[model samples]
Target: MTSPLPFLVVQTALYNRLKNDATLSSLATGVYDFVPETALYPYIHIGEAIDTPDNSHDRYGGQTVATLHVWDQYKGFKRVLQIGSRVQALLDHQPLTITGLTHIVTRYEFGQPLTDPEPPGDIRHLVLRYRIVTEQTP
Candidate 1:
């Protein structure tokens, strides 16, 4: 049988956690892997992910770095920042239920705020990243 991918497992766990979070749901419209064309403003999206092998003598392991984007049509960075903070609280150093892998730890990498310069300049974007370490379940 093929081994489960750590990147996909961690990303799926993150998506499910954020989607089911009551506080986050109150702040953002939705958490999505694929944002709809008509998706409303103020939403969270699961972005790019990169995985690196971290195997031991007799076991398989990996480090997965994932990016999450918070988008808002607000005039200032306050709204996006608030939502980003909530996300950080949920994931940083928290336990994740990744399928077929033993989750080691999740660290909050960084969060950056930027303004979208295209056309309507009122869009605020917050880019958040997390590093998750995992090992294959024996």
Candidate 2:
């Protein structure tokens, strides 16, 4: 099994990046790994994560699959999409800095926006997928 450190690193990287982004931080009030109790709407969440071995020629490494979700009830998909674009620009094919691991590469896998059904009106969910490659670093 691949180590989970890479996954956590990627998750933290996402959180930090989004939280500090002038656009996303201002648009979304909350950025979290796990949805917080009493969390307000129009927040960003680090959703699912999975890791796999990327060993070749005796180079041990991990490739992590990360998912990010953007939730907004702002009466339109525009806000959610704008935030999603910022996230994509930050991560897509962009190298990330992962503590305790050497970040090889991070790239966008796919992303889409869906109309949320739970809250009923003007709710949008942006689902994003990213692939992160990491090798152990002391």
**Quick one: best lDDT, which candidate?**
1
lDDT of 2 by residue, 1-138 (tens): 344457767788877877887877777878888787888878889999889988766557889999899998787789888888888888887767778788888888898989867645577899999988888764
The pairs that clash in candidate 2 are none
Candidate 2 yields a Cα-based lDDT of 0.82
The deviation in Å at residue 61 for candidate 2 is 1.0
Off by over 4 Å in 2: 1-5, 119-121
lDDT score for residue 81 of model 2: 85
Error at 137, model 1, angstroms: 0.5
Q: lDDT per residue, candidate 1, 13-85, as tens digits?
A: 9998899999999999999999999999899999999998888788888999999999999889999999999
TM-scores of all candidate predictions against the true structure: 0.96, 0.88
